[model samples]
Target: MSQLANIKQNIDTIIGADELMERIRAGKKLRIKLGVDPTRPDLTFGHLVVFNKMKQFQDMGHDCILLIGDYTATIGDPSGRSDTRPVLTEDEVRANAETYLEQAFKILDEDRTIVRYNSEWFNEMSFGDTLNLARKMTVARMLERDDFAKRHASNSPISIVEFLYPLVQGYDSVMLESDVELGGTDQLFNMLVGRQLQKDAGQPEQAVITMPLLVGLDGVKKMSKSYDNYISFNHTAKDMFGRIMSISDETMWDYYRLLLLMDEERIEHHKSDHPMVAKKHLASSLVAMFYSLADAKHELEQFEQVFAKNQRPDDMPEFQWDSLSGGETTCPLLNLMAGTDLFPSKKECRRLVEQGAVKVNDESVSDPKAILDKPADELVIQGGKRKFFKVLG
Candidate 1:
């Protein structure tokens, strides 16, 4: 593929493609903007789709402006929200913003990327300035957003503050004088708001490029922590690789197209190959991208050992199993998970059991509430695809 074609790969929409292309042809470095709200401390693979697009711009000799939307996050984005999001305190926003910046370095080059916080200017602006910004967009124009319209038509409680989110987000573009803004397809309206707001401010309007939202491992909803379907960048490399392997064969194509960016020919090549082999290639390649090549290779070896070789890993976590009071053989299933700190909480353990992801002694856990008798020998626990532990009596 040509360079421009490659850059445009997997792009959902580009608001000002011609002008942006013209600028690219001119060989001038453009300032690209991608605003992220730190409503959540961690990013999912869904967010990586946009980050990879920004990485492409950086490679093209353009400047990347990563705007941390500290102020707007407080109001919460109303783009795809069905109901009003809870208001956040300034401290919460700042705390999450810090984590966002720290984790962003995983995909973005620290030296080349310019990070800015909307709170820097939004905090300094007076109420009058905020009011002026709000006047730039009419209520009808704001209603053009699908989510906002649906809520209004359905008579759902649409918080008044929610209306200000896109406007405040748009002001960040004017402040940054962004030449291009990158966002997910869901943010098309907000991104267009940035383009118009910049022009209204007598600045060069930013071109908007939106990428497709990556589907989670569930192969349905968008990848997100709230859905419990997200693959977190914070997961262990082995866990990350294992989760990739769990995705359905069809969903792997979505992963390749959106996250992996394999061309049509290469993707078809994978389809002709064995599904397991293709998935391993995709899994290890993704692991290498997020972590390292060595870690990816080691993880692949571990996966093959457990699944193909039918053997426990050489390095499994060990947990001590104490007999119940009075030498009783039975123990609460939740107690073993909790006592060992195998799970963060009883709730998570219950959830895993309900999902049929928790197993003890190679048997599927029929009941999270069931008490298990003490094993005569070493007990093995396998939770989810990656978590494994050995219990010693």
Candidate 2:
């Protein structure tokens, strides 16, 4: 297919496909905008769903703008929230913005891409300016958003700041005069607001393209850091490969299609292979994307050794026994697992132990309160299916 066809291949919807195509054909280097709120420290594969589309435009020689929502992040995007999002301090938002650019560049072209922070304009604006921007949208229009409508119907508390989120986001397009905007389907309302604001400003309205949200490892919820099922771009090669390999066979196909951008024919080609073979290929390909081929290869080898052969990983991380044991002669199994940082919390470690998910030296330890003797030699500990660590006294 042609590059233009490929641009619309996997998108959920495009508001102005014809106009966008006409501009592209007319040799106008369209300014494509993708705005992201740095509410979290890491960008997940879910964010990658839209970034891939942005990269497609960058490759086609359009001016791709990576709009960092440093200003909007303070209010938090209320697109999918049922309640008011917790306000973030300027310091917190700025710090997240720094890391966001680093992770975003993994998929986006750094040299050719144009970067802008909404703070550039928002910081300069006064309360009067915000009120003027707010006049562009009505209260009825703001409540028309699904999330807002649902909240209002359910009598859930909706903050006035939440109502201003779309208007603030919309003002961004007017300021930048974007030609095309890319986002996930959840951001459709906000993107439409941008288009309307652009039209009101007498600038050409931006064509909006919304991509599908990538399902997380659970195969249920959308991939998000809050869901704790996301694979972050900053994850180590081993963690990244292991997490991908752990996804269900059913979910692997989605990853193959969405993350790898494989067409249906290509997906069917992989589906014909044994599920394990297809999954390993998917894992290796994704690991290689953020990291090197050698890193992916090494992780694959370690994965086989640990899971297929039931042997310890060659690169198992080591922790000092004293540190984990807290200088005690014995350490509670739950505490030891939590100290390794493999589990999110001691409560999660306890749950895993009760479910027989924790093992010491390959022996299942089902009791959460079980204690391990401070080992004179290195001891291999496994937490859940994917984590392994060596504790040395």
Candidate 3:
């Protein structure tokens, strides 16, 4: 495929395609803009969907802008909301913005990226300046947005501040003089607003490219931290691999397409293998993206040992026998597991025990208050499916 075609392949929508192609053909070092509001601390595989496309532009010698929406985040993007979003404090936005680049650089080339906080421009605008910008769009034009329209139709309270979000996002493009703008499909309206704002400013309108939202592990909702379905960048290699593996086989194909960017032909080829085999490959590839190949392989091997073979891992986290129990001859099962980092809380550990999810030395233990004899050797304890601990004397 040609360079433009390759970039266009997996993308959901590309407005002003001819302009984008013309600029690419002319060898223009286009300013590609991807604006993200730092509402969440961690960036997930969902963000990777667009970051991959941005990477393509960077590789082709384009100027990729990672715009941090420190100011816009306080308003929050009302793209798909039924209710008004909770406003974020400046401190909260700043703290979230600080971690974005470090995580974003995992996929984007750090040296090549141009990072800018929207606060640079938004912070300087006075209430009078905001009114002048707000005049550019009528309330009718604002309601043209699908989210706004839906809320309006249902008589939902649409805060006037929410109306400014798209305008604020659009002004970023005008300030940057962006050549190409990228976002999720839900942001199409907001991105187009940017394109229109650029046109009105007598600058060339940006080409809007909207990528599909990555489905979360649940396979229903879009990947989001709020939904608790996202696989974030900070997840450990083991957690990443296991979570990817836990996705339904149907959701696996979407992961292959969106996350891996595998074309239909290659995806079909992989579909010929056993689902388990294909899933493992998918899991390892994603784990390897954030971590090393060795980490991926180790996690894959460990997963197979624990889940497939129902055997304990050789490298399970080890704890000194006394470290968990203060050198006692016995320890309460719930207390022992809770003292270690194996479970999140004592209540959860007790629940696992009550539910028979916790096992001691490969034997199922079902009483939360049950006492265990501290083994002189190593006592292997399995906590749920993903956590394993070996207490050593």
TM-score per model over all chains: 0.91, 0.98, 0.91
Q: Rank the candidates by TM-score, best first.
A: 2, 1, 3
* Candidate with more favorable, higher TM-score: 1 or 2: 2
By lDDT, the better pick of 1 and 3 is 3
Task: Compose the digit string of candidate 3's lDDT tens values, residues 91-207.
Answer: 989889989988999999999999998999988999999998898899999999888999999999998899988999999999999999999999999999998899899999999
TM-score of 3: 0.91
lDDT of 3: 0.91
The model with the greatest TM-score is: 2
Error of 3 at 359 (Å): 1.3
- Candidate 3: minimum summed lDDT over ten consecutive residues — where? 1-10
Q: lDDT for each of the candidates? A: 0.85, 0.90, 0.91
